[model samples]
Target: MAKNSGRGRKSGGPSSRPTKPLWRRIVRSVFIWGAALGLLGAIFLATAVLFTMRELPSYSALKSSQNGQMIVVRARDGTELVSLGPSYGRWLSYDQIPQVMRDAMVTVEDRRFREHIGVDPIGMLRAVKVRFERGHFREGASTITQQLARNIFLNNSYSWTRKAREAVLALALERKFSKDQILELYLNKVYFGGGAYGIDAASRKFFGHPATGLTTPEAAIIAGLVKAPSNYSPTADMQAAIGRGNVVLGLMAKNGVISQDEADAIDLSQVKVAKEEGQNSVRYFTDWALPQLDLLLPETNEPIEVWTTLDPAMQKAATAAIDNNVPKGTQGALVSLDRDGGVLAMVGGTDYVSSNYNRATNAVRQPGSAWKLFVYMAALEAGYTPSDRVVDEPVTIDGWSPQNSGRSYAGEIDVRTAFAYSKNTIAAQLGNEVGFGTVASMARRFGITTAINTQPAMVLGTSEVRVIDMTRAFAEVSAGGTSVEPYGITKVTTTNGEVLYQHKSVQGQVLVPHYVAAGITDMLQTTVATGTGRAAQIGRPVAGKTGTTSSNKDGWFLGFSSGITTGVWMGRDDAKAVRGLSGGHAPARAFADYMKVAVAKRPVEEFDTKLQLPEWQLEPDDEQLQGDPDDYYYTDENGNLVHPGTGTQYDEQPRYDDGAVGPGPGPGIPQVPDYGQQNGAMPPPAANDDFLNRATGRGTAQDPGLRPGQGTGVVPRPSPSPVRTSGAY
Candidate 1:
């Protein structure tokens, strides 16, 4: 049909015009499609740009509303100690930022920050090539403006659409703000970790100074955190931060931001990280206090201030004392309390960085001889005077007989004397005479919250107890027998100074009888003056008691000086023995050192010296009773001495140094035959006769030579076994 029209040679016929080459047609079609796609892409990009610009805030609003909530902790004196959430310092201007910091940031983050209009094609292409070669995406090519855009508006989710949005926002930011403003915004808005936001906050938090005076290495370190705040933050990983800082220095030198020699001259070690108040030892206090916020304040994420009773200076001294006195590989914890039970200082471990177990409040360990306080209190409550004499001879209660530290004893000692010397035999005798239930009751009344095993061994502090509880008990005695509920937060308020909670220092209800408290205090004073706690003497009218567990697994010194009471514990985390580490030595020394600082500001206040009791004289010497020197004449339920017949009669026990095992259920304390050795001398010790090595603890707390529920002796594990009310303590 078209051939018929060829007679007229139609101008528009495809055959009238020679057909175009196939390749040319293909090229033309491609050009048309590319043009249409380019138009659509342009429109799509403009739409994305508009969408990204929708929710952006003005610079003023951004600055004012960035950090939402923060919990700041302060000392009693209103000194800022630490904060929990995002914390910002004063906003710094572009001129205020150190030039080294600016240079470091630019060289490491974006070399073409000034030349590019928010994004650099060369950098993008180079990053793409590297990523393609590596077969994975890597973080790079983000200009400073792009970073600022992301920090201000976008979250940390990665995607193609996210990249497009970031580029659009970056371009918009560059158009909206000058280069200096963009950089200032970037530095001020970026997260630098450690609860710090902005360069100023980061500088103050890490270096303990303002950003205006940062050193080259310090500046580089701070700037390097922009890529990954937690990774490069000095407080988080100083080594990684340092390495990245070195890389930044090298880059700065190569990019002419700094001279090569200048870069080399800087060493990250010279950059001292400014220590927070109390050298971060207060972190223990904050860790202890933050959880209590829910109980103390109204439920809200709103920022608040916890005005704790923490004595920053005392905290620093306490941590230093532990670090200096605690032997290497062993751990020590200390906590100080005021008369009202305000935690003035708390150190959970020798190094908070290495171990954060919080031994002060959380760890439940054996209190050793320190448990004698409650036994003496029970005796006093039962109408026994401190002057009442008791024989410190080996006594057996229900097949369990614990000896003194060195398997030695001091006989015919008074109550106060026994307490001062931490005589396990006398303590057991008194505990047995008063009824073990009464002794456990007395411990409960005195604030020993942990389970008291109440076995005959419990008389020697075989039960587990926390250091804080022990300190609280002593605090009660220091408060003239008033109850002491351990407290740290004195008041809580909003950042604007509106008080949310105000602690009223109410006089606590009497927890112990007046005579009982006085008696215990008297014994404590005598202990520090002449007994095992003599090492705790701080040149003040301080009173304290010492405690050492079997094989010296745990050593503790709980004391009160001036208006402050402190308890210290030294032990291994594994509950293993530390030879020769007794409460009278390292723990007592730690208590003295910490107390020296804890009570430095307070006036020396002496404990009650007057004691009321019906005094009695000792029985006249009897040669028949002197047959077996190792024999013990225990007091009956009525506080009457029960002498034995056949001249198995008990005499005054021989003296022993403080290393022998005490009288208790503490394992590894060997059982000896009753009445065989001449001159009342003990037979030579058998193997594992040192301490109760055969004693076993429950719940993974095994003694060095002991197992759970096996051989007799003090166990390190806490047990809920019923109190043997009928047995002798």
Candidate 2:
């Protein structure tokens, strides 16, 4: 009505259109604001994607970074022992992938794998909703392609940044590679646990075969490892892995990869995880050989296979021997070497899971009478035959006297007899006769690596030694005096069948004369036949020596039988003593138990040469003869016959037809503790320090060593860290 003159326009006022409904105006305003916000969000998301892509590695770098191969260690029998570093199986094309494996991977990992373009919005939204409700990031919707990209191009870190990068890389991979190619790469590079990185290696590792031969259930089992490798690996836990495999089978049925009946019929419980060398026992050998491998080859990233000389069966036997024989509170170690010095078995401790200290190769302790081996070896090399006669009375060095145990001396006995009896006095006399310098040098020449103390007491093994060194020394003797250096690796090759390194055996130099070695073997035979090492007998020819330290701190039995030199040691890690423990009791028995299984595969072998030592026989008139058990008579300190365990003495002496003087042969024989009887049952713990020092004239500022045939109490210096070089010290 106001538009009468100016064409319906109001002058001096705002112009306006016809008024619309309030609801329509409100909807229009809301639409305009929503459009602006949506544009802002789109721009922000594009900037974030670009930021994540800034650090993205090139797709070609994916295969290049994984170019480095795994280091596989195998036993002598070609059984896999362990794998070091990223391990992958042979790369397979899409066609080579078993249908079961492909379906199992797809159905269980990503239900919409065929439909998604790198990232699935539905799966991500569902996963996000579930995670938000749960308040913890547990459920994941990562596809196979996403996992492949994550493993190749990124670390397994849980962060928004990592997720952004993984998503960007997945999109890039999807854009470049075909679905089949992407699936092939994913299956070939995914980690399936057990130190394996891919389906093929995991297949061979868990099933001892190739992926081509994987059964449906086996494929399901392996596919299940993708989600949680350490928890689902058959080698880690069989029951858990089987349960996971069953879950996969259910998914396979739901996806129609397998019929429900087929999935139900699959017995994953029958899945026998390949029984490879995963025992903690083999860790000892692998630990020792790892350093050796480094020395043999220049460090590189290329995959290498190390073929070692370890006998898996023998390793099991050795571990069992230590676990069964070593006392509960104490520790034990054993090192066995072949005739060529190849390490066959090594057990550092009873349980590697409990304690990984490699006692066989690392621990440094007194050799006790085991050092007498070098002393006697020095004597034998210094022109003394085993048959040579030596007085078994007190022998002094720096005013230190070596006496027989319990002061029961076998006077003027032959060297063979004294050695068989492990007479402390005789050992010291020989050490005195043959300069201690020569004895220390003999130990060095025989492969004792620890620094040797050249003092007079060194002959009694005052210096510390390693079980591997002792075993190496014994291996030389077992090899008929040829020099030996303990070795394990035999060949190094790549998975591609290219030989990287092969051992070329060097001719061994003679460490001792053949006849001298034979002479030592002669006395060693006597020791095992009638001496302190009688318990180490394996019902066949064996030569060994028994060693017991002061206060029963350590026990040792070093021997060679059937071309294998094995050394056994039993003691505490902290150098504490085990009461009533002796070399002849536990250590020797352990030696026998191990050797029985160790030599079972080899033919019975006898020492080819024997020294023409005199036959030791107790003379009829001599007092060394074994008396009848009925003839035991209690004797007073003054040599008068008395009742058993009582001081009451009888002056009257009985006569015999043989005309024995001191005590009659029948009922008047003196009852004395038999210290030299087969070295059996760890004759009640040795006397205290004062009595032993007075008896052996020991106890000097520099000499903490015990008498020979008795354990040494030398304080062990802090041991040097184990050197892994192949060179001898």
Candidate 3:
């Protein structure tokens, strides 16, 4: 009936279409709702499984950051001169940890640290709310594990990804390790500024003690530094550091770790904030010593402990000498290398803490007269004896005229005296007599490896050389002519106590005997005795040379005792010429000062006695070899030669033949064969001389062919061969 009236009637109120079969409808409805429920149940199950099985991520493993142990430096007398890095951050077990330090860390950083798992949900939610309000993460809600993980594994950069990574790592770390393990690591990993890296470093850097030795107030002060290091640094801001310390104390008091009355009673004024010296520890030494260390021990990458030949007392004494002795505008470096090439002490610059450039090893300045040693050595080896004389007056060579330091010369002096006085002309003359090649070769033997221009001017100290090179050369002289390569590290050890490497002195022969070295040493001693190096003379036996470059631009003092060798270089850091400064002034004084202190405890002894040598061969007089023309030439010994052509014999006499007695003790001139007569033959033997012929038995007593000494019998000779341009001897 409704269908019949559909055109005029409104659509059926509830069911316009034909209703589906009851069973089909019911089944369809049940399938739709059931499929939706099944899908929801599967998602819930997957989420539950994920929550149960998921594992947090791990972080980069941190081996202990505490590097080396306190290296002790003692004097030659076994007296402790200085102690370096005395406090090492040690990871302590729960039982060994001091209660006061633990409580201070807990009270200051995290109040409910022990009660929480690895994270604090409420604290994180609060941080999230703050971040939402600020539109960025301005504050942190890191749990102790999270903070420790960040401190040890990550650097300070605020980011969501890093934060999430830190959280994952912290959760993993907490699951794998105990709370005490995390806390102990955190204690050792945190930075306390002022060159302090860990709790122990902070303790020593701040309180002049170890973490285990920290008092309650001292612990609070150190704990307070973790918040903002530079701001809470006692040296930088004492008032703020004290306020932070007081706040840490109040927190400890409120947490029942310390009594309120006890905290209030504590006087911050009496708490001595021991100022850290902040030694940018041996920056210069580190720079200079590393390359050498690498050479000495190249097998491993671990740092080698260079128990250098550095004498701490000498180092202090040297620093003081440079500070007190050098002029206001100049800076200097002083180095003392042991006979074995160990660096006993080094002051690379005026102050290593202030500057890192090592002028002593790195600066290549003109060596001045110091370079003359090589020149003299070359001359000596090339047959120009040290006793040979040379004029010290100015002489031009190769269109270059070199002048002495004072523009005056002491003429006609021996090599030793001239060298002691640093004569430029005599050195150049000797260089000319020998050759540039010989001089350069000698310099190379002395460890001058870099290119040295083989000019005659080089003999006058015009070439540039570094102090380390000269020091090694001079040390070899001190050690008896044995060339020693310089070394810094004695040994290197891994963190696990395994020996990675050790250094031994490697030496080579540069001279024939220790005597030659001793002679050189003796000559150099004269340099200190009566020459420009007189300022370097110490109470004991000392040998050295002083060098002042042109216009006094660079000053140098190289000195050595029985056991140590030192080189001092002084100049302007900018290479600008300094006025009125010479090696005799500040560098020599610095060398002397350091030597006096460094050698105080060591026993006084002469050089190794075995190095001394005896005299060498001496040549004969000149006149004896150059007297008469007849001495060098052969002539007839008899008065005349008889000619048999005529029936009556005719006398054949030379025109120049007079009773001159010529060169020999004879009545007439000794006969020399005429050019045509001796053209293809060796000359006949002298009238009264006994001669030996290696090729034939013709002249000696053992040979039957020899002529008699006086009136004589005929001597038989060997068969002759044609002579070339020169006759056979």
Candidate 4:
């Protein structure tokens, strides 16, 4: 039939049956491919994680190993001076931590720490969203557990592999340790600024106490340091640290760790950071002593304790002296030593935090008039007495004309009077007479290691010297002219009570003859009594000199008593001239300030005057006499020498006069004029008197009209008619 044939044709040809939609088919194919690709990606991620975990350090290995200990320094009396090491301080237990500190840490570092299972997925997602919105990563989403994991067993690296390891390691740590144990390890392993490691050390470094006693605000401040130790350090940046602390407090309040009222009640102004442990105000002294450690201990792996000669009271006094007397923008250094050359106090600069130049031991500067002490020592050794008369008239040495600071010269004056006035011309002539080589040799004997020029100008302190050596040189004079090798460490002991080294008291050899020492001491005493160093009088038998160089670039005062020797230097590091500054102004004041406190506990002892007169003065003969009897010596109403003499009465006592000229000088000798009536060329007596009165705590009130000859009593006659007598000596 036709129908059967049509069916057969239709069956043999393409038949139109119900077909599926293109969209459904496409959807089915995509589903199958996506499932297979996702399975491959998961396998790849699993393989990467397994490889990263293999590189992770063992938990037991990291937990067992401990860092190195500290090297502690102590004062002679057992007061702690400082500690030096990589990881220093005590390790605290979990129960010992303050609740406030825990709250602060949790609030700032991880609010969901208690709820998270090691890694906080929700927090990470939020952080990722924020980073996506910002187009860059600016915030961290590490939970406390993750942080602890990273700190303990992982290095800080920015890679997906590292992140995967951190996450896996955090999970492992969470499973192996309790929450409290994790927190304890984290607190003990964190690094704070200033070489402080762990929360306990950080607490002691910033608060001077243990972590258990931390207040809420203090806890907040410490917690803030976790972000950036140096950037948030209270010692380095207090304002920024406080700002961060306030942020922590805000977070704590938001997290309900503390009430809003409690958070608001915190007074940031009342917060005070403890002095940093290793780098306190005594860093100068410690730095100077550090190099000596090698010579002291030699070899030691155990924690050692060095007993130094540093006096805490004297250090405080020295710091106060510089802080109160020296002006801002100017630098100063002070060094105090015992008569036997033991360092008591050392201040290298105005602020140790600002700079660590160690000006006391490292800075080399000109001594100015202070160097005259060595020159005079040479002169004394060359058979010249302090009472010997030297012409103060204009003189030239090798075509170099030396002039007085005031530009007005005294005609003829004894060595004692000329030295007291810091007469430059007299010093130059004396240096030439004694031969600069002799003076330089004497300086070396006194422990001056700096290069010395043999020029006549060296007598006026043109050569530079270190303050430590200068102080040691003065210490020799204080020790009755014995050479002193300055030493700081008295003993060294290990923490286990084993003695490493004990200092032996080595008596320095007698360098200067007894008579020479006594004569120099007497002249220097006169200098403090009525000379340029009158500003350094400490109400005791103090002897010192005032040094002022050209353009006032450097100023110094090196002085001492029977007990202690001190030297002070004030100047600009750049060598810029300081206007109106003189050694008699600030340096002398600082010396007196420090000495007053240094000797407060010690008994006042008088210098030896048994050999007051040198052998030359005692054995004076007709050959040593050059002037008339009345011209050289005149008796006062009380039987005191009015001009110059070598008797004990003139030894330690300052001569005083009522501005009266006794009689006209001999022929060709200039009559001393009343310096009270002079003008610009005359030095201001009020400046000198005010400094003396303020420094010594004596003398009458400041009087501008007071003349140099009016109060001091030792008057060198001015050249009679201002003659230009220029001739080489």
* lDDT (10s digit) by residue, model 3, range 1-729: 446655777776776788889999899999999999999977875554345224423322353454333444333334444444424455555556678988999887877678776677877788899899999986568887888777755656788888876766676676667787778777777777754667877877677776777788788888898889868877656788889999999999999999999999987767886654645324556556645543555444343233444555666787787777787788888777887787777777776534446777777888887887777766555544333455677677777777877799776565557767877777777777678788878778889866798887888677888888888878888877788777655655544656666666565666535545655665576677777788887777777888888778889889788688988888887778898788877888888888888788777755432222233323323322222323233323454433222323223234343655335324553443354544775433222122124123455454221112211221222221121110110
TM-score of 1: 0.54
Encode model 1's per-residue lDDT on 1-729: one tens digit a residue: 446755776476655788889999999999999999999998987776666566567778766767535888899788988867887898989998888888888888888898998889989998899899998767588888887777766766788888887899997777667899888888887888767888899999999888888888888898889888867777646788889899888999999988999989988877887655544578878888878977877656677888889988988899888988897789889989987888999988876654445888889999999888888888877766555556778788889887887788776666667787888878877888888899889889888888877788888888999999999989998887889988888898887888899988886998876767776777788788878888899888878899999988999999997878899999998999998889999999989988888877788775774554333212222432233323444433443334544334222332224757347433544333355667586643322221222222223433222112212222121122222222334
TM-score of each: 0.54, 0.52, 0.53, 0.56
Off by over 4 Å in 4: 1-59, 62-64, 88-279, 610-728
Worst 10 residues of 2 by lDDT: 720-729
lDDT of residue 579 for candidate 2: 88
lDDT (Cα atoms) of all candidates against the true structure: 0.77, 0.77, 0.67, 0.77
Runs in model 1 with CA error above 4 Å? 1-68, 87-279, 612-729
| lDDT digits (tens) for residues 664-709 of candidate 4 | 5665434443335454345223233333443344654543322232
Candidate 4 — what's its lDDT? 0.77
Tens digit per residue, CA lDDT, model 2, 603-690: 9886745443232311121211212213345444455555443534565644334555445345755444444767663433323444
Better of 3 and 4 by TM-score: 4
- The count of backbone overlaps in candidate 4 is 0
Clashing pairs in 2: 401-696, 549-711, 550-711
Misplaced by over 4 Å in model 2 are 1-56, 59-69, 87-279, 612-729
The global Cα lDDT (0 to 1) of model 3 is 0.67
